[model samples]
Target: MTGYVLRRVGVSLVVLLGLSFIVFLMLHTISDSPGRAVLGPKATEDAINAFNAANGYDRPVIVQYLAFLGNLLTGNLGRSYILNEDVSTLLWENAGRSAMLSLSALVLALCIAVPLGIAQAIRKNSFLDRAATSVSYLLYATPSFLIALLLIALLSQAIPLFPAEASQSSSPWAVFTDTRSMALPVLTLTITNLVVFSQYQRSSALEELGQDYIKVARAKGMPERMVITKHLLRNACIPLITLIGLQIPILLAGNLIVESVFNYPGLGLLFLNSLNREDYPVLLAYTLLGGVLTVAGNLVADILVARADRRIELTK
Candidate 1:
C-alpha cells in the first residue's frame, strides 16, 4: 500500500505539472500580458514593459512554465494580480469553505441514499422501487442550476425556510454553527448527489444480492436482516467508495453552479469573480488546482477500490 501510494503520488505530480503548463498556455493564449491589464490603457509602453519584466511575464512561455513548476516545488502559488494576495492563501481561505459545504452535502447524501438504495434493491420491482427509480431519474436528469432555482423558489421564496441567498460569510467553520447560511447551499448539493449516488448504490446492491455468497449465507440459516446487513451491505457499499472518489470532479462542477446560484462564497464564486476581473494569476492557479484535485480524487478512488477488494491489483 505504501508503494502504491508513492507511485500514485509521483504520477499525480507529473500530471499536475502538465496540467499547470496547459492552463498557463491557455490563459496566455486567450489574454494578453497581465501588464497591460494591470497598468491600464493610459500607462506608457515603458511602464507596461517594466511591469511585465518585474513580474517575469516578459520571459518566454516555456521559461514561465519552468518558473511555475519551480515555484510549485517550493510551495509558492504566485500572488493574485488583482487582489495583491497570495493565491495559495486565498485558496486556503475559500477552499476550506467550499470543502465544508461539499462535505456536509456528502454526509447528508449518504444518509439518505444508502437506506433508500438498499430498500429499493431488496424490493426489486415493487411500487416503492419504481417510485424511487423514477424520482432518481428525474433528479439525475435535471441540471444543478435548475435544481438551485427550484429550491430557491420553493424553499426560500415560498416557504422562507432558508435564506434566499447565502450571505458572504468568510468564516470557514461558521457554517457548522449557523445552519441558516448553509441550509440552501448544502441542500442543493445533497439533493444532487442523492439522485446520482442512489442509482449507483441500488445497482451495486442488486449485483451483490445476486452473488453466490448471499445465497450461501441465506442457506446457512443466517437471519434475513443479518444477511442483508453483515454480508450484503458490506459488499454492496464497496462500489460506493469508488463512486464517491471518482465523482469528485462532478461534485466540484456542481459546486460551481450551486455556489453561483446561491451566492455562496466558495471556489465557484471565486472563479466567477476572477473571470470578471480578468485576474490571470488567480484564474490560472484555480484551474490548475482544479485539475490537480480531480486527478488526486481519481487516485484516491483507485486506492480505495484496491483496498476494499483484494481481487483488484494496484500494481497491475
Candidate 2:
C-alpha cells in the first residue's frame, strides 16, 4: 500500500509538471508576446523587455518551466499580476469558500441520494421506484444554469425562501448563521449533484442485487433488510465511491456557472475573474490546483477502495 501510494504521488507530480508546462506554453503562444501582454500593448519596447527580463520571460521555455517547477516544489506559486497578490494567498482564500460550498453540496447530495437509491433498488419496478428514477433522469437531463434559474425564480423571486445572491460570509459558520442568504446557491449545487449520484447508486445497487452472492444471501433465509443493507449495499457502494471521488473536480468546475449565477465569492468566481482580466498567475495557479485536486481525489478513492475491499490490489 505504501509503495502504491508513493507511486501514485510520483505520477501525480509528473502529471502536474507536464500540465504546468502545457499551460505555460499555451499562455505564451496565445498572448503572442508574454511581456507585452503583462505590461500592456501601449508600453514601450524597453519597458516590455525589462518586464520580460525581470520575470524571466527572456529565458528559453524549458528553462522557465524548470524554474516554475522548482518554485512549485518549494511552495512558491508566484505572484498575480492582475490582483497584485501572492497566488498562494488568493488560492487559500478562495479555496476555503469553494470547499465549504462544494463539501456541503456533496454531503447534501449523499444524504438525499443514498436513501432514495436504496429505496428504488429495493422496490425494483414499483411506482416509487419509477417516480424516483424519472425524477433523477429529469434532473440529470436539465442543465445546471437552467436549474439555477428555475430555482432562483421559484425559491428566491416568488417564494422568498432564499436570496438570489450569495452573501460574502467569511466562514461556513457565518454562512450558516445567515442560511437564508446561502440557500439558493447551495441548493442549486445540491440538486445538480444529487440527481447524478442517486442515479449511479441506483444502477449499481440494482446490479448488485442481481449478483449470485445476493441470491445466496436470500436463499440462506437472511432477512431482506439485512441482505440489502449488509450484503448488497456494501458491494454497491464501491462504484458509487469511485463516482463520488471523481465528481469532486466536476463539482468544483461546475461552480464556475453556479457561482456566476448566484454571485458567490469562491474559486469558481475567482477563476472567472482571472480569465476575464487575463491574470495569468492566478489562472495558472487555479488550473494546477484543480488538476492536483482531481488527481488527489482519485488517489484517495483508490486507497479507500483498497481499504474497503482487501481483495483489491492497488499495486496492480
Number of the top candidate by lDDT?
1
In angstroms, the error of model 1 at 134 is 1.1
What do the candidate models score in CA lDDT, each in turn? 0.86, 0.84
Per-residue alpha-carbon lDDT of candidate 2 for residues 106-125, written as tens digits (9 for 90 to 100): 99999998888888888889
Expressed as tens digits, the lDDT of each residue in 1-316 for candidate 1 is: 7777788788988887778888889999898768888777788999999999999988999999899889988989999888999989988888988888888899999999998999999999999999999998998899988988998899888998888787677887756877886888889899999997898999999999999999999999999999999998889998898888767777777888888998888888888888888888888878887787799888898788778777675444
Total clashes for model 1: 0
Instruction: Assess the local accuracy of residue 123 in candidate 1 as a C-alpha lDDT between 0 and 100.
Output: 98
Task: State each model's C-alpha RMSD to the native.
Answer: 1.7, 1.8
| Number of clashing residue pairs, candidate 2 | 0
- Candidate 1 vs. truth: CA RMSD? 1.7
Q: What's each prediction's TM-score? A: 0.94, 0.94
**Error at 307, model 2, angstroms:** 1.0
